[model samples]
Target: MNEEELGTDLKKRIKEVLSGSLHIRHVDTGSCNGCDFEMSTLSNPIYDISRFGVSFVPSPRQADMLMVTGGVTSNLEKALRITYEATPKPKMVLAIGACACGGGVFGETYANAGGIDPFVPVYVYVPGCPPRPQALIQGILLALDQYEEVLKRGE
Candidate 1:
């Protein structure tokens, strides 16, 4: 299906399967910090993502989703694995921007590990040098939708 259709379906499924709020833990593996700015915009006056029941938390243990930015770097690979393990099961991993999705221009460098998928499963990928806030929101919703599907399928 098209992105538009997928987005609508995600919204519907999220509402159907989830109730109340969800806490997200933001992880910055390695990047130019461009994606971080777009993420901050999500909570700003214009978008105000908190109204949608998503809040950012500091710890992975307290989070339902892992909002990952940047490509994984060699130094942080172990930390990333530990964080993923800390996150409770039935979790969703949201890979934001080109860097996190596939390492962007820094692909497979000596210091860059490319993507988070090899270390942790990525449920939704938002592709852009810095994806717009709308895209970020869509990615979050998509993650929720996928999480709901996983729960329903008992997997």
Candidate 2:
């Protein structure tokens, strides 16, 4: 299916799976802002993920998913943990960008914690120096699929 078809299908799936909406909280650990910018693009008219019942929320307490970007920095490790704990149960965590997946070029530095996996359970990983908006959407869809499975297992 083309992107339009996919968007329509994704909208339906999100509604059925997430009880109408999926609110995301974005966390930036320590990379450049490229991935963050790409994620923000989903709210633009062209992508308009809001129509799919997907929105970026300001607080983890209000989020259904955590779209984490950048490598885990020492300064942000505690914050990440707190954010994860603050989110309600059955939440999905998506590690976006290469930096979040494996720390990118700044891998395991004195100030960087390598990847988010060491800190929290990641449900999806979208790898790239900075993945495009399309990839980010794909990652979200993947996370939704996993969420569906988790629900089915009553987890």
Top candidate, metric TM-score = 2
Q: Highest lDDT: give the candidate number.
A: 2
Measured with C-alpha atoms, the lDDT of residue 52 in candidate 2 is 89
- Tens digits of per-residue lDDT, candidate 2, 47-88, equal 899998888888898999999989998898998999999999
- Model 2: lDDT to the true structure: 0.89
The TM-score measured for candidate 1 stands at: 0.89
TM-score of each: 0.89, 0.94
What's the distance in Å from true for residue 22, model 2? 0.8
Residue 142 in candidate 1 has what lDDT?
A: 66
Across 1-155, the per-residue lDDT of candidate 1 in tens digits comes to 34655445444555676666778898989878899998888788887777666688999999888888889999989888999999988888999999898889999888998988888888999999999887887777667768877989997
- State in Å the error of residue 126, model 1: 0.7
* Pairs with backbone N, CA or C atoms under 3 Å apart (clashes), candidate 2: none
- Show model 1 residue runs off by greater than 4 Å: 1-15
CA lDDT scores, all candidates in order: 0.82, 0.89
| Separate clash counts for every candidate | 0, 0
